[model samples]
Target: MSEKTILVWFRNDLRIHDNEILLEAVRKADKVLPVYCFDPYYFQRTASGISKTGSFRARFLLEAVADLRKNLQGYGAELIIRTGNPAEILPQLAEQYQVNEVYHHREVAYEETEISEQVETALWKLRLNLKHFIGHTLYHKEDLPFPIKDIPDSFAVFKKKVERDSNVRPCVPTPEHIVTPEITDAGELPTLSQLGLDEIVDDPRATNYFQGGETAALVQLHKYFSQDDVAVKSKSSRNSGSNNSSKLSPWLAVGCISPRQVYWEIFKHNQDGNNQNASLLKLELLWRDYFRFMFKKHGQKFIKAKTAEDEAPVLAVNELDFNKWAHGETGVPFIDACMHELNATGYICNQCRQIVATYLVHDLKADWTRGAAYFEEKLIDYSPASNWGNWAFIAGVNDAKESKYAIAAMQPKDMVSDFVTTWQPSPIDEAGDLMHV
Candidate 1:
């Protein structure tokens, strides 16, 4: 009998550490092949006129993939890189590598699931199985106390039950060595220009560069967990004039580190399970699980479908207010500061994100999906469920009354401070008091 080979396809789960799909492939087959596809669909400019993957996100992705390849090399394997549809790329790689099966972590979002289905269909024709592993969530889906269908719509109730009843599974051990067939070519990593985007000129104030990789992710985790103000930082307001909040989201978004890894490290550092600061940090990770599980339970519930060509921007109004908000040109100082930081660094504090989002939907009376699409393009930490779910909540599905209240409560008293001065447009737009003129 010939030796069996399994191709491990890398999606959001980029790291070898704590990755079950990588382990399962190695355990099941005699040799393992690791691959990451830069699917063009993700990099394309949608009709919404927003990039599917913007400069910041695309660059971060390239860095993460490069790091993954390097890590795989350390473990005695090469990361096979390709730029194309996964549906086309996987089948071809399967044939080239003589792979009996292909394994990947499952995704809950609509487009990701659709692409997975397409790849599954293509593999079916070649008589190779497309195996999927559920490794993205901190808690294994099977271990959940309630089924996806039964998950409470209210986040409060959901958090309560999961904490009380469920247990987070241990991290999958990283293999000492990953075996692969001799390979002459593994393809080149694509650049931002190739992905149809301008190069990123990072803002000067961005002193803390977010390096992408499991290596960097682990470093940041250790440093963040070691801080004495873990509770204060974990509960840091999303509404900040500065961009110096937590840095774990981009790593989490790219899958350089698993939520389980972070959770366990907190457990180790805190020792006692009942530590409040540790619980808050874990709660932050739990929010990620909440959005992902919510997506699984209900598909695209928050997004309103486009009715006609008139709604071509697709998610929200694509007019002046939207463009101004996207560029941080809006006259409102605080909102402008947050948007500028987001546009420049691809990140902003959660408090600022909510404030700016509210300004767009409530103050500006523009559609909410527009802000969601912009974030989808610019945010380094953009996850479909979290981005869209938060936007939907801020958009206030029940009524405008709730958003009105939220905006009033969130307005900063000292909006004219130095943080705003640093980010707002030069010359201060004499009428700076204006809102999105």
Candidate 2:
């Protein structure tokens, strides 16, 4: 019999550690072929005239892929990089290597799911299988008390049930070494320019510099989970603009670290799971899982914001307000500060993000989809479910409660931080009277 070969396709789940797809590929195949396709779908400009993946996110991905290649090589395996559609590329690779099967982590969002279908269809004709592993969420779908179709519409009900009934599976261990056939022509990682994004200049005002890759993510996992600072629950994590809230999202977003890894570390650090900081962080992770599963349960129904039928404008002034807001030039100091931070750094505090997004939707009266689209282009940590889900939640489209901190942004003074002080706009009263600057 010919040696069985498994082609591992890396998507958002980029890490080698705690990755079920990688582990299963190693277990099943005599030789593993690791491939990452830089799908042009992500790089293309959207209808908003902004690239779907902006410079910061593009840079982060390129770095993460580069680091993944290094780690794979350290284990005596190579990452074959190719820039093109996965549907076209996977088949050619399967045919060339005489591969029997392909493996990857599954995604829930429509575009990602659609791409998976396209690749699966193409691979089927080649007489190969495209296997999907559901490894992205903290609670594995199989472990959930109910089936995906029956998942609670309310996060409160979902969280309570899952916490009571389900258990987090142990993290899969990182392989000490990986075996691969002697291969030629592992491709090169593309530059930001090659991906149709401009080279980014370092922003001095960014809260904290973010580096990409699983190696950096593991270091962060060790650092944050080990720190005894309960101040992680303070303004640092909750309200302020800086990355005091674990700074793990960027890595977490890209699958640099698995949710189970973070959860187990919290479990190891606080054996009883009673540490307030750990509990709160764990709760946020649960919220992340909620969004992913919500997408899985609903598909594209609630994920995409609907364009308003009556919001058509004559003066094109709506576009003017949007341009100003996107560039952080809005006169509203609080909202402007948040937008500035997001634009300058590809990040902002959770509350601050809500403040800006709410202002765009409720105050400016612009299309919520436009704000969502801008965040899609700009945020380095953007995930379809979380980003769009939260936007929908605030817009009152998705049935959810607005966080108190977000509600407080309307008060103006209550929400101001050093981030707001930096912008230094005129203070205003409840009546919209601008106080002397």
lDDT leader: 2
Residue 282 shift from truth in candidate 2, angstroms: 0.6
| CA lDDT, every model vs. true structure | 0.76, 0.78
Query: Per-residue lDDT for 1-437 in model 2, tens only?
Result: 88999999999988999998898889988999999999999999887688888899889989999999999999999999999999999999999888999999999889999999999999999878899899988999999999999888787888899999999999998777788877888888988878888999977655467799999999887876655344443424433332235668888888988989988887877776556667767777888888888888888776443445422432333888999889878866677776777777777766566667777776777777788889888888888888888777766665443432335347444565534535432222111000000
lDDT of 2 at 246: 65
Among all candidates shown, the one with the greatest TM-score: 2
Model 2 bad stretches (over 4 Å): 229-243, 304-317, 401-437
Q: Which stretches of candidate 1 lie over 4 Å from their true place?
A: 229-244, 273-277, 302-318, 398-409, 412-419, 424-437
Cα lDDT tens digits, model 1, 82-182, are 99999999999899889999999899889999999999999999998988888878888999998889887777787789989999989989998899987
Worst 10 residues of 2 by lDDT: 428-437
| C-alpha TM-score for every candidate | 0.87, 0.89
Number of colliding residue pairs in each model: 5, 0
Supply the TM-score for candidate 2.
0.89
